[model samples]
Target chain A: MDRQLVFELPNDLGCIEGAVEFVLLRCEFCEEVSRRLRFNFRVSLAEALANAMLYGNGGDPAKRVRVEVTVESSALQARITDQGSGFDPDRVPDPTAPEQLHRPCGRGIFLMRQLMDEVHYNDQGNAVTLVLRFQDTEALLREASA
Target chain B: MAFQVSREGDVLVVDVDGQLIVGNRQELKTRVLEELEKGEQKFLVDFSSTGYIDSSGLGVLVSLSKKIREQGGELRLSSLNEDLRTLFELTKLDSLFRIHDSREEGLQGF
Candidate 1:
């Protein structure tokens, strides 16, 4: 199945949950991946959504967050775009910094990298795309159907 | 995060359970600060049963830590699982606060 859904939501941090649920709904519809894949998908998608809401809009509620999901033969691609001027994704501090451990924030990208098969960003840095494989799509479909 | 509080001598131990994400951030912030304002400065956050927390939750912890330190007291965390501890270490927050293996160790501070 090949399809895409684009959403323009206010850049409020609260919208992250709704975006995650939206992805989950798609996974349920695909019915082709396993519980592990589902968890991985949720975590990766949540990180992208969080980035869109936090940095994309500068945490401004008035801005807009755009998300698009495309399902393909071999992979699932999700793109999250935000309203701000964009940023340098390369500069995100490594959460593993020895001096930064107790601080409590700034690990979304780290977790996202750990969960998704591959993660990349567009030149402008305002849009991030996450790719997931369909290695066990048949099993996912059967499991979801049953 | 939903919290249940109890006092042990001069310390106020807050048992925060549930997902501490952006959605519940405000509640956690308000409640923790409220407890501190009521003169319960020495604090311990027991996450023994808490399973998840996001950046926003971390933000609250930072804010409270600053507030508590400003009041000439301290904030300690206890019972952090592997994942939660990873999050802390990843952000390098492990160096900022005092962490203990158990509630007793955190409370006694001896």
Candidate 2:
């Protein structure tokens, strides 16, 4: 399956769920891959969008978030771009550190990296791409159909 | 996430349903903080019905756990499914909060 969906979300955090749901509906995969995709993609996308809105755009509802999702034969890629002066993602400290464990913020990027197969940021740091790879897609398709 | 609250002895038990993410995490934080302000001590967050939670949701939980501890209260989590459990484990937050396999287990010594 090769399909792409592009949409824009306002910098409102409330829009994350709706946008994720929209992408999930358009994704096509075998049963097992679909199940994992739902959970992984939902969490990863929500984290990515939150980072874009809260940090990249500084929670400015006036800014727009551009989302472009592509479903490949064996993976799904989502790119989220925001309008703001980006911060260095490398500077984000690990949330699990003993000192930072109690801190309420700074976990979104960490969670994205954990859930997505690949996480990338543009040089400007205003945009991010999260990729999820399917496991044994050919075998899973046969199993699903049988 | 939507919640059902009840009192199990001195512990305030909250049953969360639906997804917990950035949008409504503050609501959960506010509700618990309100309870903390009212002098309620022990707390249990039951997530059997919760399907998913993003980083923001987990962050709120961490913040609440800290605040409750400062109030000399306790916080426990119960009934996280496999996916949620992995999230906690992956983030190494499983060590930060007291998690029980069942609500009964959580409420036993609370």
The lDDT of each candidate is 0.76, 0.87
**Candidate 1: where are CA atoms >4 Å away?**
A1-5, A29-40, A60-62, A72-74, A98-105, A133-146, B48-51, B69-72, B79-83, B92-110
lDDT of 1 at A39: 59
- Tens digit of lDDT per residue, candidate 1, span A1-146? 33877777777767776777776676665664654355566666767777787777778877887888888877788888887788887888776666555455667777777667788888888888888878755656668789
lDDT score of model 1?
Answer: 0.76
Share of reference contacts found in each model: 0.47, 0.78
Per-candidate alpha-carbon RMSD to the true structure: 5.2, 2.8
Q: Model 1 shows how many backbone clashes?
A: 16
| lDDT score, candidate 2 | 0.87
DockQ of all models, two decimals each: 0.36, 0.79
List ranges where model 2 is wrong by over 4 Å.
A30-32, A135-146
